[model samples]
Target: MPALTVLTGAATAAYSAALVARPQLLQRPAGLARNRDARTLTRLVGVRDTAIGLAMVLAPAGPARRAAVGARVASDWGDAAVLGVALRGRGTWGKTVGFAALWGAVCLAALRYDER
Candidate 1:
């Protein structure tokens, strides 16, 4: 579980950094460059993900860890919901949903570990 947490944390942090540093790189299915509003939202999402990753890494094992994992799960679900609504009937939506599901599973496992 600790390994899962570390891996997810690193991946999310990297993703967030990439979004901030080179938002253009996350084009295509992401479609973040479609408009200024989209780009702004993408940056905000990056910031939010960075915070989640930080929480996962810095929180001690126990309730604090559980809370961090819980936050991840919540945020992932929220992203899934938004994708479902905004990207409906699109291949990108499906891909994003799959990614969210994988992260959600990892966070759930971490939550269970923190419980013990």
Candidate 2:
């Protein structure tokens, strides 16, 4: 579980970085233009994910780890909501939904591990 958490963090942070640095590649997948507003929002997402990823990697296990997992859960749900709103009625919306659901599942699994 710990390893998975770390991997998730790393992956998310990397992906977020890509989105912020070169959103053009994601224009189709994300269904967002590479405009100023979109880039700004994408950078914000990068910042959020970077913070969460770092917390997950650096926080101690037990309570600290659990707290990070909780944060991850919150972040995932929030992302899902944002995606739902932004991607509404869009054909590529499912991609964002799937991304959020995948992370949400990871967070939930981490929470379940914490319960044990």
Candidate 3:
């Protein structure tokens, strides 16, 4: 479970880095307008993910790590909600929301195995 948490955190951090570096990666896929405001928002999300991911990766086992995992799950749900609404009816909407929700579920499941 700890290994899974680390792996998930690493993946999240890497993806967030990509998003921060290339907002178009997110915008183009989601059918969002490739504008400055969109880019800024994407970068902000990236930053948030980065922080959460780092916490998951670096926090020790037990309460601190569990809290980080909780934060990550929350973030994923938040993304699912915001993106689901923003991209509703678009082809990418399902994919985006599904991914977020699925990832959140994975993290939620991991919580059971988290050392308390």
* CA lDDT of every candidate: 0.74, 0.75, 0.85
How far is 91's C-alpha from truth in model 1 (Å)? 2.3
Off by over 4 Å in 1: 25-27, 113-116
TM-score of 3: 0.91
Q: Which residue pairs of candidate 2 clash?
A: none
- The sequence of per-residue lDDT tens digits that candidate 3 reaches over residues 15-90 is 8889999989878877888889989999999999988888888988778878999999999998899888988899
Off by over 4 Å in 3: 114-116
Provide the global lDDT of candidate 2 against the true structure: 0.75
Q: Give stretches of model 2 more than 4 Å off.
A: none
Clashes of each: 0, 0, 0
Write model 1 residue lDDT over 1-116, tens digit each, in one string: 35567667777778877876656655555543557776777778888888888888778777786788888888988888877787777767777777776787887875665465
In Å, residue 66's CA in model 3 sits off its true spot by 0.8
Best lDDT goes to which candidate? 3
Model 2: worst 10 consecutive residues (lDDT sum): 1-10
Instruction: Answer with 1 or 2, whichever has the higher lDDT.
Output: 2
So what's the TM-score on candidate 2? 0.83
Instruction: Give candidate 2's error at residue 94 in angstroms.
Output: 1.3
Q: State in Å the error of residue 14, model 1.
A: 1.7
